[model samples]
Target: MAQGAALGCLTIASLVVARWGGPAVLGEYALLRVLPWLTGVIASAGLPVASTFFLAARTGSDPRLRPTLLTLALAGSAVGLLAWAVAVPLLHRLFFPDLSPGLLLLAGLTVATQLFTVWGKACCQGQADMLGANIVIVGEELLFLPAYWLVSHAGLHGITAVVVAMVGGGAAATALSVGRLAATGFFTGRAAPSLRLAREVVVFGARAQLGNLLWLVNLRLDFLILDALAGPAVLGIYAVASKFAELMRLPATAANYVLYPRFARAERVDTDAEVRRLLPRALALTALATPVLALAATIALPLLYGQAFRGAVLPACVLLVGLAVEGASAVASAYLWGIGRPGANSFAMGLGVVVTVALDLVLIPHHGAMGAAASSSAAYLATSAVLVGLTYRFSSTGRVSTVVASRAEPL
Candidate 1:
């Protein structure tokens, strides 16, 4: 809860920067922000999912999981480096052609930053202290805000500096948190790295990475398309709206942190009964979160960003509907992935990503930011539907199946 509150505060400060900065600056900052998260998602892969289950299991019985966690981190780090080498140049030319060499260098650091931070967070979560994981998150935000403010005050060169700060902060925080965990003697076991366990974690992580990509595409493909079709300013508007929407999901995000490991433990105990007990409460929570978000986006958009941002209102509203769907889907996703159905989650996100790209091509050129919003919203809705359907079919409980069949049949 402290972490969540800190995040909420940090999120507000971020919005202040975005709101004050307006479209072009916000667009640039958005690019900076998205890169690390995208890389982090890739680096962490399915380990977050693996962490919840594996960690819960380890805490309960096996203490030999530390080496497995270390091995997974090393593997992810290697992959991250490779990904940075191949992906960053292409991405820079595509999304940030005017970027300075300094910003480019800073962006490169994201590969390492995401690798260490996400791996450590997953490890900590496995150790049942998600608070430690979130400390890194909030700490990064805290570091970036002030760092960027000071640097930008010095000169416009501040943007690159801010990016560097973010990367550095994540690395530092992760190191500290993980070191503290290690000092507790949790990772002192002389366990060998299990090829078998590594394979299982990597396989799941890879499958989950597919969904991660889809989510990446789903979340940002629209911005990329909008940037190409309309311009950065419009992308900026959508970016601001998207930031607020992320703020709205804080509750659901917090809940998932609590729920994933719990759900994982439950599945290990009895999959069917766990789903039966968890699904309704999850949906009910989603139900509660959606309208509050819609309301927040509605009220907060103008108030925070000023009348200049009134244009984001309609797009924000449209995006909130998509978020509502995604929220509901997240509940199901938590359970599905918890029970080891990452492939299903990946497949659903893949289909949704394809749909989003198709729609962006058709719609963004014609409609601009709002078009992007609609495309993204539709994609999330479809993705949510796919996840719910898959969860219902796969869940051992007739409960999820019945819920999908009766109340929320796919539209």
Candidate 2:
């Protein structure tokens, strides 16, 4: 709840900044805000999933895996930095053709912030410490809202301030989390006992990371395609539409956070039952929530983005349906990962990405944001179907376990 409120506050703050700073500034803000997500994903190196599973499995029990967790964090950070370096030139050419020199510096700073912050959060998640992670998130929101508010007053440079706050807060959280881990001897310089464990961890982490990358692209593909083919003005409308659609998931945010650990733990034991019980509940909730939120979005966007955005209503509605499919897919994905089959999950997401891109290519040049939504809706629905089928086939084979039987209850 606090997390959701914090996000709401940040959204409000950004909107205010947009109102004050004007649409052009808002466009810049949006770009700055969205671009770093790609870098953040690379920086975390899928440790969030691995660490959660690793820590939950050990927690009060095993002390040996601590070093491994620490090792992975460091490794993931390094990978993120490397990825940022590789991506900067390409992104600069694509998004900011006349990129300022200092912009690169700001991007570096943002990447640094994201790497440390996510590393810490992953560690806490591994330990099943959602409270600690949420505290860090709250801190980020508390800091960022005020920082953005003040930075908006500074004109163009204020955007830099927004970026800095993100990095600084993340760095602070990561440092604190890692410090605590070290104090607990979790990061002691110890030799990895077996090459097999390291290989398994890396393979799992990489596959999960790939799936995450695909997800990142899939979620933002509509906007990117719109911006590329339709123009900045249309991209702006699509962004607002996407935001409205994303708001529908607000209710499930808490459940989403809690579900990861549950899935991870379930997969550790009877993976199949865990998925079978969880998938339907997630799907039902998403289906129930979609239309209500879509109606709300249709009503809200005109009010929020002003009359200029009235055209986005239908696109928002389309995206809302896509978000529902994504919600169901999200739950089923947990089951896939739970059962040590992240590769299948990755393939599912990869397929969605391919489909979305193809649809965008075929439809966006002529149809604009509406076409993008169509692509997203079609692709995500297919992805959800694939994920559910794979999860059930893989995880629902054994005799009805107690946990599995209990999960038959619908939402």
List per-prediction Cα lDDT, in the order shown: 0.67, 0.65
lDDT for position 97 in model 2:
48
Task: Please report the TM-score between candidate 2 and the true structure.
Answer: 0.84
Clashing pairs in 1: 46-205
Displacement of the residue 407 alpha carbon in candidate 1, Å: 31
Lowest lDDT 10-residue stretch of candidate 1: 402-411
- The alpha-carbon lDDT assigned to residue 153 of candidate 1 equals 72
RMSD (Cα, Å) of model 2 = 5.0
**Index of the highest-lDDT prediction:** 1
Q: Which pairs clash inside model 2?
A: 51-126, 52-126, 272-395
- Per-residue alpha-carbon lDDT of candidate 1 for residues 1-411, written as tens digits (9 for 90 to 100): 645666665666557566556566667667766775566557656565565556665333455566776767666666766666667677777777667655675676666665566666666665667667666656655656665566567675535555655666556666665665676565787778767666666666767677777778998988777776676778778887776666546665666666666666653336556655666665566566767777777788778777777788778778877776554576667766666566778888998988898898988888888888899889988888888777667665443432222110111
lDDT at 205 for candidate 2?
Answer: 70
Candidate 2 off by > 4 Å: 58-64, 154-161, 168-198, 251-253, 267-271, 398-411
In candidate 1, how many Å is residue 15 off?
2.8
C-alpha lDDT of residue 280 in model 1:
65
